[model samples]
Target chain A: EAAVTQSPRNKVAVTGGKVTLSCNQTNNHNNMYWYRQDTGHGLRLIHYSYGAGSTEKGDIPDGYKASRPSQENFSLILELATPSQTSVYFCASGLWGGANTLYFGAGTRLSVL
Target chain B: AQSVTQPDARVTVSEGASLQLRCKYSYSGTPYLFWYVQYPRQGLQLLLKYYSGDPVVQGVNGFEAEFSKSNSSFHLRKASVHWSDSAVYFCVLSLSNNRIFFGDGTQLVVKP
Candidate 1:
């Protein structure tokens, strides 16, 4: 089984506050992704990284930033939190191809007030 | 650009009843499809995937999906569902660059 761990299972942040969500995977996968789950929007990708020191924008990357300092670590950052950003966030790790399966982290529930 | 669609937002069925969840994708390239299940408070789990060749693919927990290139659909099916099968099901499309797109998802409720 693949192992992907996320920190701070739940968080409550005020408007304009900075928030950081961290993810670590032991799978040694080269690709990592950050996605947010909304009630009607399902899972929308925010950011992704091909490898260490690389980050790319996703479908919804307006208010989020991502860092991939190492192959095993990927982090999502929110510079200014808003109530609209409140949602469950998930991190996934996988190989750099369409045929490979992605392993997901448990998820983080964030509430911005 | 690739996109996935799950028209049904929710579906309810009784225990031991047959189940089918619809999924459609819009992509011009060779499509790689996948079905995933998400329980409460957890991440998504891969139920099955279709790369090529056989259209029908079996997954864990008695779940299966059939890929139809003619219709651009990969619908999920189960002969008989249990209460444990109740969860959110998502259809996904993956690109060669490792970018994956997910449908809005269908919530399954099984009555015992």
Candidate 2:
């Protein structure tokens, strides 16, 4: 079975604070992604990583950045948090080949107050 | 860019009743289609996917979906739904590079 885990499941930060949400996957997948879930809007991509030392922008990558230091780890960083940046974040890992199968983490609920 | 559209935002059904959730997509060529379910505050679970061959595919929890090339639709169905079936269901489309687009999920409220 594929597994994706994220830390700081629930976070609350003041405006202009820096926050980093961590994710780890056991699938050894080569692709990882960060997304946000909001009401009336589906999962919107924030950032993604092809592999270690490679990060790419997604549909909504303006307020955040991504890091992939190793195969199993991918992180989402908010340099300066704002109230509008508050949303439930999800991390997903996909296999390198064969349809790019994806497995998602439980999710991290973040709040910027 | 490929996109998915789920027309229904909320769907209500009684236990032991047949259910169907509508999903429409806009993409060129043979697009990958997927249906996922998300319980409250939980990650999304893959229900089914269609890449090629059979237009109809079966998934866990007695759920199934049929892909229609003509209609550009992939509708999810369940023979008999239980109370546990209540959740948010999303339809997605992806091709390569591990980037997929999702539609605003359909919230299914199965009343017992």
Q: In order, what DockQ does each candidate have? A: 0.86, 0.59
What candidate 2 gets wrong by more than 4 Å, as runs, is none
In angstroms, what RMSD does candidate 1 have relative to the true structure?
0.9
Residue B81 of model 1, lDDT score: 98
lDDT by candidate, in order shown = 0.95, 0.91
Q: Residue-wise lDDT of candidate 1 within B1-112, one digit each (tens)?
A: 6799999999999999999999999998899999999999999999999999899999999999999988999999999999999999999999886778899999999999
Give lDDT for model 2.
0.91
lDDT (C-alpha) at residue A97 in model 2: 42
DockQ class, candidate 1:
high
| TM-score for all models, in order of appearance | 0.98, 0.97
Worst 10 residues of 2 chain A by lDDT: A94-103
lDDT of 2 by residue, A2-108 (tens): 99999989999999999999999998888899999988878999998889899999989998989999999999999999999999999999976435557999999
Q: Which candidate leads in TM-score?
A: 1
Candidate 2 structure quality by residue, lDDT tens digits, B20-62: 9999998777788889999998999899898989999999989
Candidate 1 chain A: worst-modelled 10 consecutive residues by lDDT: A94-103
